[model samples]
Target: MAWTWTYETADGRETGRSAEFETRSDAESWVGEAFGELLEQGVDQVRLFDGSDEVYGPMSLHPA
Candidate 1:
């Protein structure tokens, strides 16, 4: 299945999305590495999806 990441704001509004990944791990890793930039671009959270099915979501980009 094609894996992808969806970008969002703190209030659940979709802001953007990443390019399709070949694997879930690749998608997750991309997010982990790019989260800093994403935060700078006003993306507060992210969601992972396998095709149209959501795998997980709303992960905060900000540090706890």
Candidate 2:
């Protein structure tokens, strides 16, 4: 399975998603660790998406 990072702009109309990662855990961890920096830099929001099931964050970051 692979993982993807998605971010929606503050406007809520614009959205961008990243490429897939080798593992979901890696993806989630990367997002978790990068979120603060992104937010600090002015990112609106960050979310993790699973390529396999199309599930979003809150689940991706959950401990497995």
Q: Considering every candidate listed, which one attains the maximal TM-score?
A: 1
lDDT tens per residue, model 1, 3-35: 988999999999998999999889989888998
| Model 2 per-residue lDDT tens digits across residues 1-64 | 6678776666543256666888877776777677766666556765666664656542222233
**Candidate 2 structure lDDT:** 0.62
Local distance difference test scores for all models: 0.92, 0.62
How close to the true structure is residue 57 of candidate 1, measured as C-alpha lDDT?
84
Error of 1 at 27 (Å): 0.5
Weakest ten-residue segment in model 2 by summed lDDT: 55-64
As for candidate 1, its clashing pairs are: none
Please, what is the TM-score per model?
A: 0.95, 0.59
